[model samples]
Target chain A: MPLEDQLLVERSKKGDREAFEHLVQLYEQKVYTIAYRLMGNHADAADLAQDAFIKIYQALPNFRGDSSFSTWIYHITVNVCRDELRKRQRRPTVSLDDNNSDGNNYTYEIRSTAPGPEEMLDRSETQVMIQQCLDSLNDDYRTILIMREIQELAYEEIAEILGCSLGTVKSRLSRARQALKEKISKQMEPLSPCKRLAK
Target chain B: MRCQDVMELLSPYLDGALATEEREAVRLHVARCPKCSAELEELRACIGMLKELPLIAPPTGFRVGLMEKIDQLPSQQGSSKDKNIFDRVTGIARSSWYRVVAVAAVMAMAVGITSLWEKEGVQFLPLEQKPKGVVAVHEPQKASKEPPVVKEQQPSQVGQSSEPGASGSKSAVNSKGSGVKQPDPQQGNATVPVITEAVKKQVEGYVPKPSTGMAVVSASLRLDVVDIEAALKSVGSIALDNGGTYLGSQDSGSIGIKVPRQSFERVIGALQKLGGVLSYLPTEKDVSVQHQTAKAELERLKAEQGELQTKLTSEPSQELERQLADLNQALLKQIDTMKQLEDRTNHCLINITLQ
Candidate 1:
């Protein structure tokens, strides 16, 4: 934990609201990104991130120092996402209808994007295509990829946050990349038959 | 490296987590393996694209907004030092009720003392079987039959009395008399005494001494209920559920009952559901602190009594010996009262006054 975060946590537990504001300002963006990438929506991600902060406030006093504050917050964020996932599973919905659907709904794609960022210009169709490719991934695959790649969490940290073993984190990251690669390749086949044939 | 193995390390490599050795192994293998190399190239492009993905900062004025929200939050009621002082003062205030109860008790006790003091002291004939000192005097209603000793005693003689109320004087005498008589059972084991005897013994200080151990716990709850029976049933059920027997109850107004401490909350919740709870007060009474002090005192008394018994056997001075016996008797009396108080507190008294 940062010295400031540790100090803030101490002060917050003593009911110092100012110290806690410093904490919220520091991590809200990172926390928001994790929620956004996992859920693949602006509003839901924003809501989940806000909810995670509220939980952090409630659970701060009971934090026993077993893990780093980042890791603990990461775990909480992931838990909130998983709960959102399970809720969606319980009551499936058409993904495009409502962006702010009650957490019990999500969308899935048949194929995932290929591995790597094939240099797309900023704000170009390709960039949009790449994001769509990411959206095509299954919840599990997208989550592992986002945590490991975008968030740059270590296998152990990812494992702790997701409540899985290091081996599971490794395997999921592997399959997620493979799935994305296959999806991207399949999407590109019609655009260039020669490229497909050459491969 | 196999496709699966290469794929696992690919995410870590993209994240820059791969150790030098593993990075070398993957780099060396992928260079010759066209398919794996292509996959690695694509993975690299994905990382590049992720890097360029627009950074979405929290909404405008994120920190300012957050700080404003946090500032609006409730602050700590007091600092540690203040809480410490509050706790100490509150503790004293909480237990001060005992002093109030004690004063009332002292006044009630005054009447009994005059009768015990006025009667001729009961002297037992030495038992043939027991030692000469082992005398048992049968004085059934001994204090009760002695008609109002308060009426006959000279006002001036009672605590250097200045007031005309000698009947009330008996109250003061009984209070002192009760205080002193409270330690006799430690003298010897005869027969365990009963009700009036127990009261006299307590007034005189015999067995099952007065307890300072009684714990008073209070709890209240609010619930929506249709009628009084439902509330009564709920309270009864709570007590029954928690292995507590309901002692007493009131219904037309709010209900009140004493329960074991362990049953405190369960009973309170049940009663709360009896009506739409307008207000609630819940508290725990812990006699542990008082019990601990009383036990230490009892232990000291027992040790002193043992020392005096030894002195009574071996010493020769008459005045010294009588003084020792009196000390031994006082300690014994106190020890008994202390034990009774312990029993009372250990019972975990939960008093529920519900609306």
Candidate 2:
């Protein structure tokens, strides 16, 4: 934590509304970005980000600074989005006690916009195509890819956040990367330099 | 190692997480393999695109909305410092969902039986209703050590509410020192001065000095009024009376007004008189630094534009045309900055939120 953030955290913990707003302004951009990436839309992203901050405010008293404030807040953000995704999926909450082999069996039923590679001729902007591909992926793969590639969180940190083992994190990241590659190639074939180079 | 094995290890290899022997094995296989190498590059490019996604800014008034939400919450000085609220809720739900449902079902059955027993004709239980009477008279203790719990559930309305611990004085704000939270807004009349002690302190601490120079000043006032539309119209008329223009509303339940610097104090006073204030924030920025910088940059850009115009007129060339375009871009940007500063210095903006 920076000296300024430490002081602000101290003030916010004491119920200083001004200090708390200052903290919000400091991290709102990154939090909003994470929410936008995970939620894939503006309205839900705004709501999720606000909800994440509200939870953070409610939970600040207990925040003993075990991790850096950013990590804790990002973890909260991820959890909030995960809960929302689960709710939308209407799946039973997976029990942590269950001896699930790799936490990989729980795949969300995404309405795949995944067209075949041959049909991927109408090219969009690279950024737009990439986001579309991300939106088409299963929730588990999308979440893991966002955590690893966008947030750049460490493997150990990712494991701790997902409550999974390190091996699980590594395996999931690999599968997510492969999934994203397939999605992108399905949506953006000619635009993919590697595909053209390989041909 | 076969190509299949190399392909599986490609992701971890990109992250440099593979051990020495395994990394060497994958590396030697990819050295002769084009397909496996292309797969690695493709994944790398995909990750790069994901990383390159631009972060979007939240809509305006996000901070304001969030702060208002926090204000309505129960006292912030909480005791549970070990785990977060989400974790606690999720833990219970995951571990004890069945137990919780069983308890709820049992309670429902008990309620049904009790209602049956209470019926005169349909007596579910046979005996001792009239045999023995144990009347326990409970006294309402006003001086109990525990304070009353105020559930601020609904939208908190402003103005003349019979709020808890409030003197109900019509002077608007609770000028006295009290830390009482507003009673449930779903119920009637939280009609006291609910301007919190912290808010009052902050408002008093910000004493704006008289400014002869151009300065941009603004204030944020939040009131939980019963009628948002009426309050907004009332505030607009008040601003107009003080020679201010209504900037209209950017969002629901909020209005923005711009008043001349001279009547800024009068406008603030009149607006405070409109309803009960939930929170107050006053801010002033001496834009001398900005004004001075903008003015100097504006002058410099104009002079450069003049020079470019002269060059373009004398020499008809593509180079001169390109220079002219570049100068226009810079000149337009400089003017935009200066114009923003001038707009800021013109008047004071009062952001009134009627919730």
Which prediction has the highest lDDT against the true structure? 2
Looking at candidate 2, what is the lDDT of residue A26?
Answer: 95
Worst 10 residues of 2 chain A by lDDT: A103-112
Q: How well does chain B match by TM-score in each candidate?
A: 0.33, 0.36
Q: Going through the candidates in order, what is the number of backbone clashes in each? A: 37, 11
What does DockQ give for each predicted structure?
Answer: 0.11, 0.24
Judged by TM-score, which candidate is best?
Answer: 2
lDDT of 1 by residue, B1-355 (tens): 6866876687666656688999888888788888777777876665565544544454434455445443343222212222345665565445533344444344335434533554646423222443211111122223233323322242334444334544343443434332222422212111112211222222233343333445645555545566656566677677767777666565453444556656556666666555676666665566666766766675676566556545544442345445544554455456555665654544444444433
Error (Å) of candidate 2 at residue A64 is 1.8
Name the lDDT value of residue A154 in candidate 1.
77
Query: Model 1: residues >4 Å from true position, as ranges?
Result: A64-66, A90-127, A186-199, B1-27, B60-355
RMSD of each: 29.9, 24.7
For candidate 2, the C-alpha RMSD (Å) to the true structure equals 24.7
Estimate TM-scores for all models.
0.41, 0.50
